[model samples]
Target: MSRFDENKFRAVTWVQRHIANPLTRRLPFQTVLETTGRKSGLPRRTPVGGRRIGREFWLVSEYGEKSQYVRNIQADPRVRVRIMGKWHTGTAHLVPEDDARARLKSLPRLNSAAVRAVGTNLLTVRVDLTD
Candidate 1:
């Protein structure tokens, strides 16, 4: 799986720049989900790449099903996914589409120098936008 991540490092940097940085963050690309921790019930925030599907916003888990966000979704479907400054509330779903699967396979590579590079093959989980 990692062999496919030619730019795992660069991709991580891109993700951090888009998701972690405060000034340059934007939506439908660099987004964060503010949700409650399942066990602690405390607020937990996770950065994610989101897609717009029709009138509703959509999100996919590019990392895997074991991610904390996935667990959070299972615990409580109610969630707020933030993109850029604007945001939307939504529920998580498993869309199970070929395009989504292809997108997962086509993730941009990370630069070799970027710290904390990623290599694991991620799974996509779709998010259904809510009012």
Candidate 2:
């Protein structure tokens, strides 16, 4: 089987569709965030795991460094997110080394941390939206 089998995928889908709600947005921590490429000028949207910090938000992707989304965010922090029938536009920033490390620790999933360990090699963009 792949990293996550069909059953796991189905369960994840069910959770993303029904179990996760506004009241418990935290339950479904991952989302499909959209952004534009800086150089290519191509439209791109990818599902990634993100976390909200006080007012700002951060997304940690496995392909943070070479990913076009990462490059696009670096070139321009402006971004939009669609979740729970709401659209948001905001400014994004690259998380400093210290902050990135701390964030990796807070993650309950070891897999997430392992992925984040490559964070320095990748790009971690922090998006801040009014909504």
Candidate 3:
């Protein structure tokens, strides 16, 4: 990564981690992705934006592997997602071949717009709702 990209990533991630995420995660309408903390072995919830279709939920990770939640997912694919105040257990799959830009087009607009604007290494994630 170039110096500019690295700097931008640091700035954006800081704001999201400290400010945006804390506020949004508490909202009942906001989608929350829950993962087992790789080190702490505790549940970690992150506010995300995605569209649920049938038994699948699709989302884009703005920071790819650098995102803490994505790293947690890598350690443990088993996860839970809260949608409309309901939680569902699922498995998260990282699709490197998928075009994240195109995938974002089919997701929730406001969040997608933010993701597209601030994302440096966009990656597609699909979660299969098992129950």
Among these predictions, the greatest TM-score belongs to: 3
* TM-score of candidate 2 to 2 decimals: 0.60
Which of 1 and 3 is ahead in TM-score? Answer: 3
Global lDDT of each model?
A: 0.58, 0.59, 0.95
Alpha-carbon runs more than 4 Å astray in model 1: 1-29, 96-100, 105-119
State the local distance difference test value for candidate 3: 0.95
In candidate 3, what are the lDDT values of residues 1-131, reduced to their tens digit? 78888999999989988999899999989999999999999999999999999999999999899999999999999999999999999999999999999999999999999999888999999999999
Tell how far residue 86 is off in model 3, in angstroms: 0.5
TM-score of 3: 0.97
Clashes of 2: 3
> What TM-score goes with each of the models?
0.60, 0.60, 0.97
Candidate 1 lDDT by residue in tens digits, 52-102: 556455554544554576778778877787755667787776554535545
Worst 10 residues of 2 by lDDT: 21-30
| RMSD (Å) of each candidate, 1 decimal | 6.3, 7.9, 0.7
